[model samples]
Target: MRIVKVMSVVLCSLGIAFAAMAKDMNVGFVYVSPIGDAGYSFAHDKGRLAVEEMDGVKTAYVESVKEGPDSERVILNMARKGYDIIFATSFGYMDPMLKVAKQFPNTVFMHCSGFKKAENMSNYFGRMYQARYLSGMVAGAMTKSKILGYVAAFPIPEVIRGINAFTLGAQAVNPEVSVRVVWTKTWYDPATEKEAAKSLLDAGADVIAQHQDSPGPQEAAQEKGVYSIGYNSDMSTFAPKSHLTAPVWNWAPYYKQIVNQVKEGTWKAESAWPGMDAGIVKLAPFGPMVPQDVQDTVTAKQTEIASGAFKVFSGPVKDQQGAVKIADGTVANDETLLGMTWFVEGVVGTTE
Candidate 1:
């Protein structure tokens, strides 16, 4: 009887230990749009779900938080609630996140697609331009009008770099192709974005690509019977007939890495820009309309990119004014790419 009682006591102690360990970690995410938007925030929410799968870790998120003061309030509240790690997934949240990090030294902060950092804050973004360039190759091959339209969110370096890369890739496949840009200035407004796509369609664009958070552009392309490329996630389901491909984010791997680092006590504040090689970004599968030849060519280029054998921003790259931005035999470095504020030669748009 005494031996059985001692065994029960040992089991009770193990249960208490397990409960303590389970309460050790809490992670929070702040999103600029609702997860149902099926775009950028949806992709980030997938990453948060991945983090939740880890043992002894719990995750929570507040979505549709505006980028300015709303973001700052949400982040500060999460920190105050004892969230060990907070991820603010939007470019405009950079300054606000930096402000919050100063007050919470023990909490880890990660901002997406931004350039600012603090002692307890880090910034991260995927090299999505590489995949965008590949999608442009597909659009260039299929376009009969040789004119592609882009629905852009903002004129920040991230959007500008993607436009330049897409243009370069299209030009590589079809040197005669040109891209037109229309800015919506709002990230998740469907009506404005669809109107922008319609304007591009009216301007004789046979193919449309977008750096936006809504499927509105895709819907516009479909209604017009034109081809389109998507962003942030695979949007084929929205416009299967029109979607040729997309440059998508796979944040699970990177998010898991960060969570593991924090749990292991080895995390530090640094900028992380993982690319195709790291499986952080990729080109979505081709639609049925994409010819086998085009698919094969894109796949070959994707392989080269993944192996680091080909750099997307290799020069003799020219600006919209026919002036050289990157000389021949030179590959554009991260600093140049990060601060890009001008369009490439084949693009028709004002940076402002």
Candidate 2:
């Protein structure tokens, strides 16, 4: 009886040790908005959920984190709590995340929509502009007015890329169309976004589009009796009647890929440049307001691009001043697009 009791105690200790080793893959995420907001941060949180669903991985997140020093504080807190991998999901978290990566050499850190990397840190973002460009094509074909309104935040390259791609797509269908841009310089300011949309409407823009992370712009479109293109996530729920479609970035596949690598001991600091081809960037369902023909045309074009038979930026392209930016017969590559800071002809706004 004494021998059996000793054996049982030894078995219990061994079981506890095995469990501890098996639970080593704890991952953490930080977001700028509430997970339930149904917008930008919500999409990223969903990606984290998908990672959690993976066997042998534990995922956790801290939402509503601020941009600067406070963001660093949150990341450091996660590290202190024994998280093995940390994902900071905001452009503003770039510097802070890099700082923390230096401080925590053993922790693997990833920042979304940022361009800095270290041995312990890496950046990842999708070419959501591909989807945005397709939506713009639909907008051009659908809009009766040649004047399109763009509600945007800061004139950063990330935002500028979408505007340019959307403009290019719109021009593909309606050469006479003009995209009017208004900057809110904020990510989720409802009041600012609404007012920006109103200002664009007041300027005779009949179709609305936005790069901010609020449903306020869509709400403004609904009230003004115009159509809208949403961003980051599908916000048709906010303006079912006026919503057109959205360019959504599905991070789940990428999240799962990363977690699997960590589990298999092959996780490396690499950039994720997923597009329509890889199913990372996609157009949300067309709203009830979209015409069937418009949907067909958009989907066809998307398919062509995905299959590599079509090149959206293959150009005979010229800047606003008629200077050729991309020479005829040349396709603009990722590096060129990333450094782009010019507006094509007929786009009305300064890139400040």
Candidate 3:
């Protein structure tokens, strides 16, 4: 009888230890593209790596997830597997993530570059347009043709806003500068992006800027001996000769903060759109070809932006039709920026 009681006590202790071990949080990540060495997915994967290093957290990720029903299946499977927090890191995953969040009320779903939200889901993105503006300053000063090319992924508001900000910044420096845009629709197609850049280069564009994930446009510029600005991450390594600065994302701090909030059971669904002031969006280092005066100008403007003394979308803004959009001395609010559907003056492309 005594031996049997001792065995029961040991078994109970083992069960308790197993329960404690299971308490570790399981975090899952869904990526829209392959996490290559650089670009949008790479930037977010860096954040995932950082969060995985924290104690008592186990991380899992599925890369190259399509943004449709396939993504919904993957997300649902992750939730079913007992993932505590899931991050769908793509704009197209918004609806799917929301649907999964509804079915799994206990799991937390965070969607990047999206607007929808549920009780267990939240949206987050940076004001990347601010950084795009800074990079445009470099493009405007370096371009001899006063004609810039933008290789874009989609015609969504995010891409539209970035293009507008880039045009505004270039015009701020060189009034005669005009921006030409080509939409590839796909976010991470290198061949298509390179072809689009070459087409722009053939059309007298001396400077190329891109919103696509790959360094294809930068590579094309280097081959043609032209300048280019990059997006998502620093792409100078891919085209050292023609590389200018890029708009970069720093998502590690935000990821760690969200993980901690979820761990503490204090996380709430909120729309987070942080910018330069929060270190969420920033400019990569300028290339050697950038003149000192231009660098100084961009730096001064960046400082003003960080201090909230300057607004990128401030008034006297106009559409392509020469009609005034925002009156003089006025500023566009978050609502106006989020719902942007028209091209600003100096843009040479259709938003359709």
Candidate 4:
């Protein structure tokens, strides 16, 4: 098949368009980790499945390609191979994706967890902080030590905003609660992630939250007999007894939306950060460990958040050193939240 671009109309699997035949659109996925990792990358792969299951969409993915130079090669190869749309699923893939996108303007490209946007390019990510905030609600009620730990993956604003949301949610329920942070700086290094969790557990934390893809923190929490929360996917399998809840991403809906738009000639640049209402962000099953009352409270708060009546990062916020980050009655908007760099009050020093 020629590596040429499709126009407004999409081909059906049976050589026709939507006349009871499968739509034959080629879609591609570029992953930061393998789908079998059962964490961040796994979730994105699930989304690829969502696309494949669609009537006319066929999906292919390249896994474990590192960022930078390798990313450029990966995008070029996929486009050269005739993939209709390529989805770059890592923050670091931003520059490479942009470069390749310029070269292949006919190909539709989507980058997740990135901040860039262009005519033929769009950005998509969920308001995972909403789920993080809900999980912190459980951590607040369950912690007996009044200390919660967060294992962070990087210092980016996305990660930083999550830390703030988690801390703010915990303190909202328990005034005495303090969050201790440990930045591993590596996304999937099990050893570094586990060591970071161990350090926090040693510091008197009774519950843990994490942005890393591995279940190391949840596993460590189980060993320490403390409750835990997860990211990207439900990690309860790693620590059944220690599980609380998780901030799982539901990219399937978004994928379906974009692909259908592409197949219909209605595609356009769009940015989305949907929360609970939009169903893009969701809370994994709460373990039997969390009490009903606590679950009820979190459910109610989530409703408010979905309805725009509640904001986890509403202003009148402060940093760890007691500096005001958001003045009174001020809410932290998307710009501020995306650029956040400071830890809020109640977090201990960096675990590093």
Candidate 5:
């Protein structure tokens, strides 16, 4: 009887050890908006899904969490629940995520679109302006009135950089083109964004582009019989005939790479700002309305940007006031681009 009992105890201990060994790595994601929005959150969720498919990995998420105390609470909850890694996807979540990272030193935290980073936390964003420049080329080629409409989300550097890049691209193709901007100050308000698009249209803008989370601007352009550009994801379905091209985000590969690195005990904290060459950001396919010549031209430019043979912010760049922001025979670096707050020449909008 004693021998049997000893064997049972040993067997039970081994079983418990095996069960623990088989446990999957838990990953958590926090989003500012619902993944069903088919916009920004949706794009990140797609990356989460890719991570979910990995072997021995499990993922969960909280959606529609606000930026302030609410985001902090969600991140803390995930950390306390023993999530191996947490991803807070929003600019507003930056400070909150940094706070949580300091307490949960063992857990890894990744914040998107923010500048804060801790010993165990990292920030990452794509060079979306590169794709924006390409999309601008498309918009510039398609505009008939020489007036481009832009429905913007906020006056942040990210949005401002996109607007400026778009303006530069349009000006590259048609020096006579001008872009008008209207701010909605909200990320996902479809109705407000659509109205802003209409207002720009009313002001003689024949093409619309947006740095927003909804397809509202695209709908407005379609309703007004003009072309439109989209962001975050392929929005061609929403506007169909009026859709031109979009600067889209593809986070799957990057997310998968990070998860793999973490699992292998090789993950480190750093600012990751990859661009088209890394396959993080890309321009969506052109609509049927885009001419073949335009497509070829943009494709060549895309190749140039990806191959490091061209720099979008190369010299002679000017601000809205026509003051030289980038001198001739020079190029703007990542730091300048990150803190960009000025609109380029040919853009009719205030950064404020």
Candidate 6:
């Protein structure tokens, strides 16, 4: 009787150990750009680091993966290697991830800044325009020329939406301010981005803003003795003289929640677009050059936004052609915001 009891206890212990081993997850990440000091991929990599801090999770990543066939191959390799979850952190990886997800249905896939999803795949992004608008206010208040230069990436809805929000925020504070955009057609080219910034500076823009991934624009502004706004992460470190503020991303919280869902077996394929209220998107600290009154005003507005008392895309908004796109008292819905293709009034650029 004693021997049988001991045997039973040993079997139970073994079962518990096996269950713990089964809970271990192998996660992977695919980055379109090098996880340099700062930028979009660097921000996502920070999220991956947060996930690693959790129990029973192992992480791996392949950075600077080109967004075409190379990304598909890399994703398929990770899925085959038994990665339980994979995050494709680029807009162009949407189709590649979708195709790989179909083949590896058991492995969950998450794509950032894209619209495609599958039974085992999901998409996630933040309403970064909220932060963009606030940064625009800073530019409008600081610019002597009233001409803000925006160095842009591709002319997708994401870029267009940000530019419009910045322009709208500037016009709200300084009615004479106008934004001029120059596209780089690349997300992470420092040389091209800097040249674009210089071109804008030469064209009478006293302030510079950007949607590109590098701090080249900020550096350019610093060299030219002008103020600049940054994106993806705080760029003040790169351009102390010119950095005003940035609309930064904090991806750690969202990553931790998603990993927990996967571990608890509650993971589902859905689209998530969180905003300031969720702490997914935020503004970097103001530069020393920003005035106290300007900081107070921005803080007041930021509080209103976080508490849901104000909406950035509320109506009475118009396009550059003087035609009202959103009538007064009527707010634009998520669908309209996501599919935005026109510039707001006071913006001088073509979507094409």
Per-model CA lDDT versus the true structure: 0.91, 0.84, 0.91, 0.83, 0.90, 0.90
* Tens-digit per-residue lDDT, 162-254, candidate 5: 999998899889889999999998888889999999999999999999998889999999999889999889999999989999999999999
Candidate 3 per-residue lDDT, tens place, 234-322, comes to 99999999998999999888999988887765677899999999898999999999999999999999999999999999999999999
Sort all candidates by lDDT, best to worst: 1, 3, 5, 6, 2, 4
> What local lDDT does model 2 show for residue 251?
90
lDDT of 3: 0.91
Clashes of each: 0, 0, 0, 4, 0, 0
Cα error, candidate 4, residue 297 (Å): 0.5
**TM-score per model over all chains:** 0.94, 0.92, 0.93, 0.92, 0.93, 0.93
**Model 5 regions more than 4 Å off:** 1-22
- Clash pairs, model 2 backbone: none
Clash pairs, model 5 backbone: none
Which prediction has more favorable lDDT, 1 or 5? 1
Q: Estimate, for each residue in 1-352, the C-alpha lDDT of model 6 and write its tens digit.
A: 9999777545533433343358688889999888893888888898999999998899999998988899999999999998888999889999999999888757789999999897678999999999999999899999999999999999999999999999988987999999999999998999999999999999999999999888999999999999999999988899998999999999999988888777766677799999999999989999999999999999898888889898999999999999999999998998999899999999988998
**Candidate 4 lowest-lDDT run of ten:** 12-21
Per-residue lDDT of 202 in model 4: 98
Q: Which 10-residue window of candidate 6 scores lowest in summed lDDT?
A: 12-21
RMSD of 2: 8.3
Q: Model 1, which residues run further than 4 Å from truth?
A: 1-22
Q: Give every collision pair in model 6.
A: none
For candidate 6, the lDDT comes to 0.90
